[model samples]
Target chain A: MMHLPNHWPYIAAAYGLTIGCSLVLGIGAALRLRRAKTRLAAVESQLRHRESSAS
Target chain B: MRPTPYLLHRYANPGQFLRLARALQPWLSTGAIIFLTVGIVWGLFFAPADWQQGETVRIMYVHVPMAWLASSCYLGLAICGLLSLVWRHPLADLAAIEIGPVGACAAALCLITGSLWGQPMWGTWWVWDARLTSVLVLFFLYLGHIALIRAFDEPARGQRAAAILALAGAIDLPIIKFSVQWWNTLHQPDSITLTGAPTMSMTMLWPLLITTIGFTLGVAAVIFARLSAAIHESRTRQLMARSRLNRSDRSAA
Candidate 1:
């Protein structure tokens, strides 16, 4: 097994923070996009249904 | 590539942007995963430790990328601001709104990671050096940008206000870049630059380059994703308002 270097904890913490923040921001953006697209799709489909029924 | 009318002449329209972003996302995300994984693993395990800084130098793989991204993100923001102010591009306003928080996150991480790396090397978690102080200002600037972008009741007014702030905030970026050379600060000078050969070794440089590319891809993915959401939500709002107007006319008739 490879020996770990001194001050490994700091290194670990830094990596953890970088990875964590990136994931949170990335996932949050993806979710917002998903929600907005879904809402837009639902409204568009609803309007389509209403228009067809009216005609 | 910037989404300015100058750069993205064909894809400046939101619909064109959406089609392109959706097509590129899978490739971007997949490439981010691959490069980040390889780069991190190689930097942590295979890359030689700094002859001086030892294993702690591994932090640079992450720290440098965040630092670069934070600065580059702001540059992108300033460009978007210019686009908004000069051309009155609605997409530029939308892009600015989305870039604000992500850039802020990058700046915050750069500060935190720098602190983490500092404790082991500099023997303190914090310092008031020019490089450090300038970056702190950048963090605040990002926070201010985010807040200012949402300050006004009218979105257009808020965008204009934020655009001016972004332009003003850009001054700090050069200071952050040259701080170490200009002052006898505790922070070290840059290892890489466009004008000169990199001081860092080939082994370390490869991983750093890969990681930088990976992080950049990640940023593009997030910003594009957020911009997509904003555009879709705006469309949804317009559709809802039109539907309500049509219903009101029908009832009145």
Candidate 2:
């Protein structure tokens, strides 16, 4: 097994911060997409119901 | 010759773009994850450490890619702004708005990682050198774009204002790119040149390239996902408004 370098903590901190920030943004965007899709589906379904009842 | 507007109009439709985005999102996200994992693993464990910087050099695998994405994101934002302003393209505005927050996040990452790298190598956590200062400015430009887009009660007005700001802020991109060369800065010059061979060895360069590609794909996936959400939100608002209007009309009759 390779021994970790003395500067391993700094390396870990840098990569950790970067990956953390990126994941937060990416996952946040994904969740927003899911919510928007659900909202749009609900709206469309409501419109369909209104049209069907009217006819 | 075919006019530019003719081509712009062809791809300006939101429905068509949403369809294309749906097809591309899965591929982009998957590729981003695979490449990022490979690049990080290769850079950290497989690549030889620098004679001077040792394991700290591994930070470059993330820092450089974030820096590149930060700059490229602004460029993309400016181009989308131009399309929004000149063509009044609906999708272009959505793309511009969606890119702002992601670009800001990337710029923030670049700054934070650069500071971390500097602490061990430069004996200092921060510097106001030309390259560093210019990148800070880039980060602010992204923030300004994000702020301007949501400043108004009317979304269209906000978008137009933000589009203008994005175009104006584009002047900073070149300054950030050439700051190390233009000024006597503490920062080193570019290691990778477009016309000349790279300064680093293939082992290091390969990981950098992979990470850069991964960052690009990752950014694209996030932006497209956000853009789709923005479109859907707009459609939902329109549908709700129309339904309310219909109810009001029936009551008025």
lDDT of 2 by residue, B131-180 (tens): 99999998998988899899999989999998999999999999988998
Screening candidate 2 with a backbone cut-off below 3 angstroms (N, C-alpha, C), the clashing residue pairs are: none
Worst 10-residue lDDT window, candidate 2 chain B: B6-15
- Runs off by more than 4 Å, candidate 1: A1-5, B1-9
- How well does model 2 score by local distance difference test? 0.91
Candidate with top DockQ is 1
Among all candidates shown, the one with the greatest TM-score = 2
TM-score of 1: 0.95
* Cα displacement (Å) at residue B81, model 1: 0.5
Q: How high is the lDDT of residue B60 in model 2? A: 98
- Residues B1-253, model 1: lDDT tens digits: 7654566556568999999899999999999999999999998899998877889999999999999999999999999998888877768889999998999899999999999999988899999999999999999999998999899999888889999999999999999999999999999888898999999899999999999999999999999999999999999999999999999999999
Candidate 1 chain B has its poorest 10 consecutive residues by lDDT at: B2-11
lDDT of each: 0.92, 0.91
Docking class of 2: medium
